[model samples]
Target: MIARWFRLAAVAVASLALLARPAAAQQILRDAETEAFMADMSAPLVQAAGMEPRNVQVLVINDPDINAFVAGGQYVWVHSGLIAAADNMNQVQGVVAHELGHIEGGHVIRYGEGMKEATGITLLSLVLGAAAIAAGGAEAGMGILGMGQQAAMGKFLAFSRAQESSADLAGARYLSKAGVSGKGSLEFFKKLQNQEYRLAIPQDDSYGRTHPLSGERIQVLREVYTVDPAWDKPVDPKLEARFERIKAKLVGFVSEPAQTLLKYPESDRSIPAHYARAYAWHKSAYPDKALAEVDALLAAAPHDPYFLELKGQVLLESGKPADAIPPLREAVQLTNQPLIATLLGHALIATENDANFAEAEKVLRNAIARDRENPFAWYQLGVVYEHRGDLPRAALATAERYSMMGQDQMALRSADAAMQGLKPGTVDYLRAQDIAMVSRAAVEQKRKKK
Candidate 1:
């Protein structure tokens, strides 16, 4: 799931409940390879937007629908379906640049305020409607959207035509400045044009409904590409290779083993083919076959951290935590990636050795420092603290986990317990106090509403 709370200063944590709520529960997908590829595509667009790449996160939602949107100005949620639908990395990058246009143009805030005023529904509700659309509850979401439209002049929360035009123009500029083509944006709109005619359900046409492709928008993009110098820029061969692997991996993990095998027959000896087969074998519960395929991958790219990480994941999931450690440790050292570090910590904790437990605590703490928004890291920290008989620390970690997840009541209860065990004025104690104060206020506010 997407981490509901964005990491800010500690002082900002207490104000979370007072901030806007999400439209629906977030279902975020975390994968090292996929995320890395997304980051690669996003970096140029983010830079072209005059924004810090670190400040903009590209999050993948697990839903299988062609949808993407910017929420909270910090996150861009792209459905896995969009990636699956894309024919090239540039197509995906075009979408990212467009969303960045929304962020850079400050359209989200302005459009949100306008929609709230026009529709008389909180922006959160509209977001929930979008989530419903993404989750295949199109009929339900359209009903909600229809209510908003009927309330006003059928505007609902969709972006105004002027705003869409501005975003399209900005997106083209960003892509051009980044030495990427506007062709992808044009092609995507062409694809949407086809969908607009073919798709029956309003909300089911996610990109069409949200993006609202127009002849003018398509014409404008076509003009931009024709005049822009970057239009003929060759696709980055390395990026294409990575995108292919990512698609292959996604198919292997998300598709049935039979389908995966059929797609990647034994005669296909390419790296991506082998990678897909490995995951397919693993998912089919044939660890030996999986290991053999992974070994082939390791032999080809001996130092590839993802391959090492995959080996560790396969071994760990197959109930060999001890054997998992060596590869996981190597992976962490090679990459120092937060996700891999967390996985290594999980393997360490699972081993249940005293020395391994202590090491796990250190690794988890470091991972949490870098990735504070990851509740899994905090939960693992709690597990480590509990193993070491540190109840106070464990309680505080649990409070943090619940707090980030927006579970104010549970956060308050855990924070209360933590505060009793911890000394006053310490960092943990102060954090616990903040959690308790904010969570208690939220609970009381909820009660008053009831």
Candidate 2:
């Protein structure tokens, strides 16, 4: 369903929203758990680097091509293929540091903007916003994109030779600052430089097209990692493991299922790769095989809450909803997971009678608490409230959803029903204010952009 259309409207909505603040990275990608794990692992630890993960977000694009690029600000859209092909934490960190270099050196804002303007794509912001959204909810779906829609690619790129050299030099310095040996950066760039000819594009249009790098980049990088060099730091063990896990998982989910299945071995040889393959099998709906794989993972690391959640999902897919409850419950209790709440809510509805409705409500409540803007969660909560004879609550939830979607009349009508016999100072009134505020902010941002 996602691998279709360039949802210009959705992207427009998102790009407009970003004027106010960066949406949660999960918004652009469907897999919330993997992103959360990566976010945690990428958290700032080394104070000497003068960098904070909060300000610089690493996004995984669902593209199979070996590419990664930066937009204005601290966003680095890494192609899923790059993540899969780049083994271990160091390679991933090296790639990310290079991107961080782009951010630190302001290549995205300084060069990307200059090019976008030069190419007559200023209005292209809205169009590209639409394209990004159509690439599969770039606002909220894990930088949802595939190689399929390079259809419109006439090279919306920028960055001169000097800019690339600067980014490379800066990236090397950042590797040292962040306390990750510049080793990863050198190795990764060396491969790209070496394979510049192997790529389908002409030499002139390599990573250099988007981010120019001359001989100086490689020249400096080689010497930077030399023994007793100016400064080189070791990569953290914990951060390295996480990079491998996220990169591998992203690979399976984005790659062709069959192709991914063949390459993704469920083995102790590399636990992260095996886990990613297991996830891909589940996504492709081979639940029995997925369960077998996840069970092996559990045996290897039984305390992993994520593995437990995966088990629950597989059971649900394999027609054993009853068996799914325990593990999912464990996952939620451990992390208060957002997606698990929705899944667990549905599982409860399927297995238990009306008496189990409360469990579903709890899930709905948590989902809403985590993301007030998620329409699906609000609608589910409304349904639960209506089922429980809580007419006002149902009306309020539905009305708020309508208001947020910009259906003002419907929102008003629903609010009228919801606020019946309701006091002015009640919860419904408070919710109404919150809804109106969000709608106002959204509208105001659009107007300002225009």
Candidate 3:
């Protein structure tokens, strides 16, 4: 039961980069691109909302169509297509402002409420259903709608036009109040209107599925912007560059392998073009070609960890775990990331067998500690613990993971293992009592510590 509907922001590039950095892991340039752009565009609007810039995180989905949404109370998700297609900073700001309107006006919470009433599941369960979908999809690497919730696949996308319109009205006002160009919101909707007509031929909910009925909405935006004049801020070229690079990188990951390989770079006939080709060929499983391409990239920028990490991932995926070792080790030594540590743990388990079990176990434990939110890490930890003959501990870890993930059946199995291992009147049960107390406190603790 994969939920494909929880798409509100760009969640894949960072997740992939975090998972794959063995020899030369590169930070996702796309999310960083969106965040940097949003940071500049959000100033006026956030100032108006009376919120801090750091409290907000802007991310781009690898998706190429126009769309935006908010997750929970933070992190606005914009499609990279929106970034590529935007004419200026004002248009982008308008999109951000619209989503901000949802958060500021509690439209996101409303959607959750509607869905809960519709599906009879808690908000946290909905998020877990989405994460389960993501982990399952990881078998195919990365592509379009990676963050799309598993629940969406179950035909459960629930956002009414009223909610969409409310968000839009609130968005326009937020833009005006924040002194951003409110008129740009109208212009943004107008483009979507034109896109709607162009889409009348196919009619498959390209951008207007949740944000429905663009024609009338476009008029409403126009009226609002005309009446209120907000600051007309100019677009930054650097932001545009980041946007283009994000598309290029996403295209690197999701485009048809052969098609991507055929795209040649005009800037540098040697390095960048080859780097692009390497991505396609390696992902397509042509190891010799990937090796040859990486050799060329290394010749141009020998110390670049990004290229090195890519080459390492290719090697590991190609059934050459030994070949993947040196570069991945080098990458870890360079970055000190728990992400690389986890990848290395996997490599050791798959390739080194029993020889490196001790090392893999230790590294993965550290990785889980650093990022418990990664369900994959928990899954891997269970595997490691099971291998060590600690079946009861393995079951507990897996059950805890499933509990966190909202997979009650799987969690129940794991929890049963730990409970079976327990004695009636002992410190083990007492320790469990302490954990429950802490969890109760966690639910009641609303404010973050300073």
Candidate 4:
């Protein structure tokens, strides 16, 4: 299941400039298996780009657009729709390679140069137009204004196209250095080309566009890709198999239940099919049916941790937390995935058994130690503290959760409450104070922006 975490951050707009929009809050989909897969896929490309693999992150956005981009940091933001549209893991790797190219090229950082040039042209035009209007030549003034605006747009678009082309070449070089085939890169471009045709997008008019036309990109990249030594190399079969499963999983999770059933009918009993059907059934409120699909999956791959996690999730969400514990516990042990551990901690707390509180606290603390970005884990830990009658630590936990979710005011209040109860200079108290300071800064920043 996709663990949805809402983060208040600006939407990235570096690559796929054609789809650029105003900054807004976006949902990030975090899943242990999917994240691990993306990390594995991007590792080689990140190394080839001369960057630390640990510093580069491939994050999945919950949007349904078939786009991916780099947003001024070592992060590649991939839309869920991109995964669904991809035919293989190599296709996704190709996209990651391109985003890394943008990162290495410092295109986002250099974007200000292009903006500055365009702004200068616009300002010059405004001055010239004002002079013409003062000289009683209104028509000429309007013409000057129109020509200047066109020139400014053209200059900006040209700059954007060049950056895109440079990134494409850089991506090809990285793919070659990493010993990965460029076949998927070319194939994905062909897919985009076909989409252009379907949308009746003009292929010849490239000057006014933010990105080069798909046909033009393919024509230029083909010369480089066809001559690469790894052009014919086969993709990793295991990675490709994982890609198929996640692709189907995303489809089931995002699509309507009826649509998922139609796409993966009962007759299709493969692992990917079962995975998709399980989510569909679960979303449709058919716990028995969902469990049946999960059971089928488990019967085939008895030791698969993800299937076990699915079983645990289905049972837990269906109001049977006790029954969910066994599989979840095993899943947590098999893969110390913080998300799974968080789920297990939630299940333990949900049982309302006082005896379970100690284990829940321990499990949640361990999970948070591994990954502090998870807000739900913090919330579950807070519940454990509350149940144990540790009010100060519970408030501290609430502050942590609210801080992560960008609720600065609520975090401030919770942090203040926690500090009043906690002894000064202790770890928990200091952490609460840190949250209070950070929340104050964030609140002030927002106020200034407004």
Per-candidate Cα lDDT values, in order, are 0.78, 0.62, 0.61, 0.86
- Ten contiguous residues minimizing lDDT sum, candidate 2: 1-10
lDDT of 2 at 143: 28
Lowest summed-lDDT stretch of 10 residues in model 1? 8-17
TM-score of each: 0.84, 0.68, 0.60, 0.93
Q: Candidates sorted by lDDT, descending order?
A: 4, 1, 2, 3
lDDT of 3 at 189: 74
Question: Between which residue pairs do clashes occur in model 4?
Answer: none
Question: After TM-score superposition, what is the CA distance of residue 223 in candidate 1 from its true location, in Å?
Answer: 0.8
Better of 2 and 3 by TM-score: 2
Maximum-TM-score candidate: 4
Residues 233-322 of candidate 2 have per-residue lDDT tens digits of: 566677677666666666666666777667765444576767777878888888877787788778988867778887888897778878
Query: Where does model 2 exceed 4 Å of error?
Result: 1-27, 30-33, 45-56, 70-75, 102-165, 200-208, 214-216, 227-239, 265-270, 367-376, 389-450
User: Cα-based RMSD of the predictions, in order?
Assistant: 9.4, 11.1, 14.6, 4.6
lDDT computed for candidate 4 = 0.86
* Model 2 whole-model lDDT (C-alpha atoms): 0.62
Better of 2 and 3 by lDDT: 2
